[model samples]
Target chain A: MKKLFQIALGIIAAIGGFVDIGELVFDTQAGADFRFQLLWAVPVGVLGIVVFAEMTGRVAAVSGRPVFDVVRMRMGLNVGLITLAASLLINLITLAAEVGGAAIVLQLLFDLNVSTLILLSVVCLVLVVYFVPFGGIERIFGYLGCALLVYVAAAVHLKPNWHEVGQGFVPHLPSSALYAYFVIGVIGAALVPYEVYFYSSGAIEDRWGTADLNLNRANAALGFGLGGILSIALIVVAGEVFFDPHIQPGYLGTTALGAQQAFGEAGLVLALVGMLFAVGGAAVECAFSGAYTLAQFAGWEWGKYRRPRDASRFTMAWLIFFALAFVIVETGVDPVLLTEYAVILSVVALPLTYLPLLLIARDRTFMGDHANGILGNVLGWLYFVIILGVSLAAIPLMLITNGGSV
Target chain B: MEDKQMDLVYRVLDDQLVDIEGRRCGRVDDLEFDGSLGDPPRLYAILSGSGTWHRRLPRPLRKLGERIFGTGVSGRDVIRVPWEQVEEISSVIRLKAKARDLGLGQGDERDAALVAKLPKS
Candidate 1:
């Protein structure tokens, strides 16, 4: 029963932790613009995340080192420094966006000022990070985040033509640059670098070892798989409800109304609650990922599992990250807009992060008997190539589409 | 284990260095060798810290990194752990000595001091 509960909790965390401000914003925009035409991108992105996340988790469990550690080790100082600089910048932007996102949700619920809410969001996050145990943090946000499943219900309730929904799964070129931009956005948002950084480090935090390999695989598959389901549901909800009215959801409140449209007041309340926790959880993830990346790269003590006094540098890193993020959000940049830029830039930096993980996971000296096998290698290289293509094309696509505003 | 021969670049260089208590200390940013040209280069110490990494950078960036993270009075701002002190070489380089014992604790100490000034929970 204990084992079963662990697996179940892992899956829930993955699902709830998967969708952040980026996904909520971009997936909905994709639906509003292309009406499910980009649905294929979600699964493609999910598969890519699962493959690399599994490799990352395996490396952590077996070797007792997280992804960023391997990245710095395998890539050496010069190349590793470049990767760290890029990832850290993207992480800060993502952290700011998530804080801003949580603030927006609070505003939607209470009609509070955005600035006040942003400050409150940062304060709450600091308290949570400082006082809450790792497991407590995961359970509180991960379980509450399940409120987002309301989209699943909302998507089903709005029952559109089954044929059209199925057709969305077929890959096809978009008719315009804007549609193509959403395609890249959906994919980029799904496979953000921070997810891998957080997941692999979380494995080490949990004290996973060779015995936990099967658990790692199950967690990545079920957790991220359910996350993909939520992504698809968000797109479906937007396609069914927003497409008809030509309403583009540019705000967090607009996405919640999809729930209101389908399930009335109850749905709106749940949607807001869900967005609050999901985005809040993402803020924590991004802040921790930044600290983790820096600490790992610099070879400092890290992990919430360690006492604050024992891991002071790690503590300082995260606190500074939150403080900086709060300052950025306080500047009044739109949270959703920040999320768009962060995700696209993250897409451009994807290969720098994953390429080293791919190489290390296959190295016999590093992974020992747990090294990537025939199938893992084939899929790893294939996705490496695919991720490379997306990284190269992300900037061009974003430029041509003018941040997907075209 | 006596007959075991491993490639230094593959096994040691750039690997994470962990203390005996399983705490991470730093990475093997550069290696020091004691032997001359004709002699097989004998590993002397494992070097770590931003200074070591900075030294590895191309000439221009090296100067820039040095300016940002000042070089120590010794002119090499690195924590050098003698290779003899290494307990094992596997996925990570485990040292028999604690970080502070080897003077690798300066960074950790500075950061901890800063954190101690913050309001505690």
Candidate 2:
């Protein structure tokens, strides 16, 4: 019973930590634009995250090397450097977007100035990271982030057509460029590289070994599976409340209004609170992921398990990233718009991130018996191809759609 | 036979380097070998630092990376861990000396000194 409870908590934390500013923005916008038509992309992307996360998580647990370390070892110095540069840039932008999004949510809830709140958010996140133990940060944010379940409740309460909702699961060729853009957006948002970097590194920090392989699978499957359900709920709620072509949700506040339409003032407050913790959690992950990648690649000692004083460069990297993120967001860019670009641009980094993990996970020398099984190999390569295609289309689609505005 | 058996590029180069106390020091950024061209070169040392790794890049990026990171160590831009110090090479390259004794992680130490001056906890 105790073991089951611990596993349940792990899965719940995973689920809570899954959705970030990118998923919230893209899922909500995709739903408002195409209703249930884009729903197929959520599960597709969720399954992709599960497959890759499970593989990479296993690699971390078995070998004690995280994603970036594998990138350097397998991809070599030149290609590894390029990948590191690309991922770090994307991580920075995503970090800024999450921090900005969290500030916006705080502004909505407390009616405070966004600039001031942005500073506050970064400070609090730094403090949380400094003072909170690794598991504490995960559980605190994860448990509170479950507040996003209000979207699931709102989706059902709005009472959409069940038949149409079911049909959304069946894939269809998007008839227009806008539809195609959202398709890429939803997938890209879900498959952001930071999640893998953070998760694999977290596995190492938690001291996962061969014994934790099943636990890794459970966390990836159930945690991400439930998070995908919340993403679908976001789309469903937006589809019902803002189905009109004119009612596009451009702001984080407008997205929360979907819940307001269902449960009024109380619902709005809950949605805002959920957004606070979820987006804040994402901001924390982004900062840590960036630090992890840098420290891991440079072969510096890193892990929140160590005191900040103990892991000096690693500590400095995250602190500097948070400061940089604050500067980027303070330029008055719309957090939602910044995240849209971050999501789309992130697709370009997806292939580079997943390819090394796929190669290393299948190697018997590295993984021993825990190497990718037949099923794992097939799914891993299949998603690699899909991610490659999505990356190829990502930039051109962004250009043609003007960041998916059309 | 040992040289033929172990794929240095696969197993040694770029693997994490852990000191005797099990603290992570750096990576095997480059390797040094002893012997003339016609003779069979034997592994001599494990080279680590931004300088050594950046040298593997194309010249243009190499210059830029050097400019950004500045070679390494005491103007050499890398620290050398003699092949003799290697305790084992498995998932990580475990060394038999302390990181300080190996001259690895000088940058980390320097930066750590600066970080120590800040208010922590």
| Top candidate by DockQ | 2
Give the poorly placed runs of model 2, Cα more than 4 Å off: B1-4, B72-76, B118-121
Considering the true interface contacts (CA pairs under 8 Å between chains A and B), give the fraction that model 1 also has: 0.66
The digit string of per-residue lDDT tens for model 1 on A1-406 reads 8988899998898798888998999999999988878999999999999998999999999988898888887787788888999999999999999999899889888998889999999999999988899888887898898999999999999987778999999999778878878888999999999999999999999999999999999999889988899999999999998998999798878999988989999999999999999999999999999999999988888899987767888898898999999999999899889999999999999999899999989988678999999999999999999899888888898899888887
What's every prediction's RMSD, in angstroms?
Answer: 1.7, 1.4
For model 2, residues A1-406, the per-residue Cα lDDT tens digits are 8867988999999888888999889999999999999999999999999998998899999988899999999998888888989989989999999999999999988899989999999999999988889999999999899888899999999999989999999999989999999999999888988999999999999999998888998999999988999999999999999987559899888989998999999999888888899999999899999999999898998999987767889999999999999999999998888898888878998888889999999999988998998999999999999999999999999999999897
lDDT of 1 by residue, B1-121 (tens): 3457777776788888889888888888788889887999888988887776567788888778888755633324678789998999877888998888877756667777767776661
Compared with the real two-chain complex, what DockQ does model 2 have? 0.73
Each candidate's lDDT (Cα)? 0.88, 0.90
The local lDDT score (0 to 100) that residue A105 gets in candidate 1 is 89
Worst 10 residues of 1 chain A by lDDT: A173-182
How many residue pairs of model 2 clash at the backbone? Answer: 2
Best by TM-score: 2
Highest lDDT, which number?
2
